[model samples]
Target chain A: MNVEQHHSTWVIILSFFISFILAIMPLPDWALSWRPDWVALVLIYWCIALPQRVGIATGWFVGIILDVLNDTLLGQHALAFSLIGYISVKIYRKMRLFPRWQQAIVVFALIASAKLLGVLIHSLFGSPEMNQPLFYPALTSLLLWPWLFIILRDMRRTYRVS
Target chain B: MISKEERKLVLRLIVFLFASIALMLTDHNSDYLKTVRAQLLGGVYPIQYLVNWPVKAGQSLSKNLNSHFQLLGENANLRDDNLRLQVKLQKFEDIKNENQRLRRLLGASEKLGERVEVAEVLAVNINQSRRKILINKGLSDGVFTHQPVIDAQGVIGQVIEVGIFSSIVMLITDPEHELPVQVVRTGLRTVAKGMGTVNRLSLLYLSNTELNTSIKVGDLIVTSGAGQKFPKGYLVATVIQVNPDIGKPYAQGQAQPRSALERNWEVLLVWQLEPSTVINDEFKTINSQ
Candidate 1:
């Protein structure tokens, strides 16, 4: 059991590292606003699948890293991710029981909340006007959730990662 | 045990939320975290490079896949462009000599040659209103904050933050950006404010009276160099619209930026000239004379 848990730790870190790459990957000008929130989606999946191991602290750490990556106001993503992490942990058990499509809806809500929180933080820093297209990433995140879920699940099971 | 775990989670969330707010407040209010940000960027730099590798590879792959005929055509076109530029270079040399002679007569200090370094654009801000781009050059490459960034056409932006191997450039079209500009035709000075649109910039501080007499559509606008951050006399934009407000004291005019902010793959970072020291030296020379 100890060995299994230790191996699963590598899996979690590796998943997050890939998500970080996806988060910063360059998209074409037109598709930039529509690019999915890769980090948030990955954190949500981990929070649901391995609630005890990954939770609010992990979210905060990842958020800080993302804040540095995006070059935005520091801590803006941290605040949003912490809140999303809390919500995910709070509902992880119920979320695990839902159908894949229904889970996608939950993912949408979670990611949207993070997006809204980010906009609110940005506005507080004197940029009050929000762009309409900023919400497109949430939609893409929702659509990508099922595929992400399946892949992460397959990796976890194949590796016997708890 | 489960209840204890839930309580711990709640406690952790509160702690993180508080820390985040504190960090945001400090980061926005001052430069205390600039070094910290730079250090953090060093860690992220490798990941960014890796993330961008595939795109670079694909671009080279496509270029390599081009037929011999296509390469020959491109090479011929480049040769033609080089010949045309050579002809233009002769005229520029003559102008340079004439300008130096005129400056000597006026006792004005000669303008120093600007040091320029080319950097490739790594990524653009995903957020629509921010209008920033990340470039591959940074402090290690002698890039500093407030260095003017330009493309083949004109001024694109300025470097706002420099990491170890990367930097962030805030484009002139960002909503938060404004630059001092002058009309090349009339020499009318004004401030051009970004209108959150890539194609347009708005000229501000123009009185309704001056707008009528001094400004005209199609007038070329260039940097005034008042702020000492951007050098004087780079093509910035051209006036496209003049709107007179009946009630307001100031008339509104929009100009199109000359730089291809969206399309350029590479940009030039120009070191700033010390305007104050130059002015002081010129004054000393005049007083001695």
Candidate 2:
């Protein structure tokens, strides 16, 4: 209802918007498997930073958008993303205390779990058989976490997102 | 966190989890959510276009960066190819006329009712696990589910999902796709299944005992118009490998798709000839009689 409040909310929405673009951007065949799960990574960052404001509801909605974007099942990503959001929200305090490298490790575990949930859901519908390539996106998300965390943190600070 | 707050969050999580699982089950088993997905896809279009904008700019910039010599060489080659194609077209027109006459003489019903419209590949799905590409054509362009798509080379795939302004195409190389094809040389029919890789399709359901000697490397496989999904005579793939053993149940073969499925930027959306054309053909055949 507040004009200023709506403007600041744009910051969070914009971050998710950019993440969606990166998630769908066409990559050359050689680099495709290693593409980071941009939506999941951004969802994790927001859940950790503003747990109450950007937790399960945000993840679930963004995930529905992702499901449509990927043209997979309507709720395939919604389910995974809500789970990611809940986990991050519950563990936000501990994650904030950890150093950046330690945070990266947590990021790896969270994303790996999310991807595992994805594979589980995929198997239910008989798509995307579990293979070595399934591991690469999570690994790439882990490798990108340090830089992404700082960048998003700076954006949140600059925009005073919370 | 307060116990009440924690309980609320956990409760919300369960709700979301169950809701999504139900959504997936229904979406997979039926088309109940097609309109919802189409509307959602419309909302997602801005992001797809935003991601494509820079890539399109880069491509246009690179196009102008070609040297004069290269342009001249390309022009000369194109001219030569156009001439050659025109000669082939002349033969094709005559052949079509002769075939139509033969069909009339035999009192056969009309065939050859396919049309094509051009579309550009807008974005490839970032999820490499699946072989889906988004094309610029959609419901607005009369694109529909199961419509055949092709490139200059041969059959590429078919449209799977149609949004308001764009559609998603599942390439034939996807593990989920199967095309019914007939061998040009031997008339042996079989279904080709995608092996979840680019440029390869595996022949399925060919009886090894009878089809073993017919399939060979370099043989051409094409649509047989079995299920009316694709029209007959579209080149689907060329046989690259064949191994038939009495020990195995079906004759085994691999095919190299004729289209550059992953690389082509432009494709043709094939449409069955309109009913008016059928009427015209019928009139022409009656006049011949």
How many clashes does each candidate structure show, in the order listed? 0, 0
After superposing candidate 2, which stretches have Cα over 4 Å from the reference? A128-130, B104-107, B274-276, B281-289
Q: Which model scores highest in DockQ? A: 2
Q: Candidate 2 versus the native: TM-score?
A: 0.94
Write one digit per residue (lDDT tens) for candidate 1, span B113-222: 46688999875343455678889998799888888999878999998888999988888988888999999988999999987877779899888888768999999999
lDDT of each: 0.85, 0.86
Clash pairs, model 2 backbone: none
- Candidate 1 chain A, run of 10 with poorest lDDT: A126-135
- Candidate 2 on A42-145: residue-level lDDT in tens? 99999999997999989999999998888878898899899999999999999999998898888888888888888888887877572646668888888899
Report the TM-score of chain B alone for all candidates. 0.88, 0.91
Tens-digit lDDT track of model 1 for A34-81: 889999998999999888888888998899889888778889888999
